[model samples]
Target: MSDNSRLLRRLFDERVRDLGLTAAQARLLLSLDHFPDQNQCFHADRLEIEPITLTRIADRMEEAGWLERRSDPADRRARILHLTGKSRDIVDKLQSTVEHLFEDTLRGLSATERDTLGKLLDRIGENLARAREQEPVHG
Candidate 1:
């Protein structure tokens, strides 16, 4: 899985280089695009990254004018994330690149095979989540 992830990242990076985005940055932007109303902490949880790391990324992206952070009206302590015009301009192209990559990667798989693989991966993910939940905490 790690190998596959690395390969996909490599391909993604190659494709998005013209947009001046690293794979991680692109992922962050994509996440914000999908869940515009969420705060940075929520995004960190969804991205499975440490909050500080996501904050750092958010800092850089904000500096670059790719996104903005606004205080949530319902929760003053939380900040909602939104894409900037620059990010909005490129998001559709980024999504297209990702879809193309997926299609290329799954080119030879039959529909049934792809469906089976998806189900198996989902089950594996559930098992991993269960294992993590059952793990004993260390102090």
Candidate 2:
């Protein structure tokens, strides 16, 4: 599964190379699209990334005009994320590129096989989630 994920990410990175976004950056943009107006901390938690890392990515994207950071009205110390028109314009293309990649990746798989694979992957994800939940938290 890990190998497959790496391959898929590689393919995605290749496809979006002309768009000037790394796979991780594209994913961050997509996630922010879904949950707009959330602060950097919110995005870092959602992406399971270090806050400083997300902040750096946000900084680059902001400079590129792909996104903007706005002061949160409720929390002056917090900055909310918002996608810019530049990113919005390319989102559909990005999504289509991923869809095409999936189609190519699963070209030989039958519907039943795809369904089984999806179910198995879901179960594995749930198992991992459970294991993580059982781990002790460190400050």
lDDT of each: 0.90, 0.89
Candidate 1: what lDDT? 0.90
TM-score of each: 0.89, 0.87
Taking the tens digit of each residue's C-alpha lDDT, what string does model 2 give over 1-139? 7899889988888988877788768888888878888999999998889999999999998999999999999999999999998888788888788789989999999999999988998999999999999999999
RMSD, each candidate, Å? 1.6, 1.9
In candidate 2, list every pair of residues with a backbone clash: none
Cα misplacement distance, residue 87 of candidate 1 (Å) = 1.5
lDDT of 2: 0.89
**Tens digits of lDDT, candidate 1, 7-122:** 98788889988788877788888898888899988999988899899899999999999999999998998888899888887898889988999999889999999999899999
Residue 86 alpha-carbon offset, candidate 2, angstroms: 1.8
Q: In candidate 1, how many Å is residue 57 off?
A: 2.0
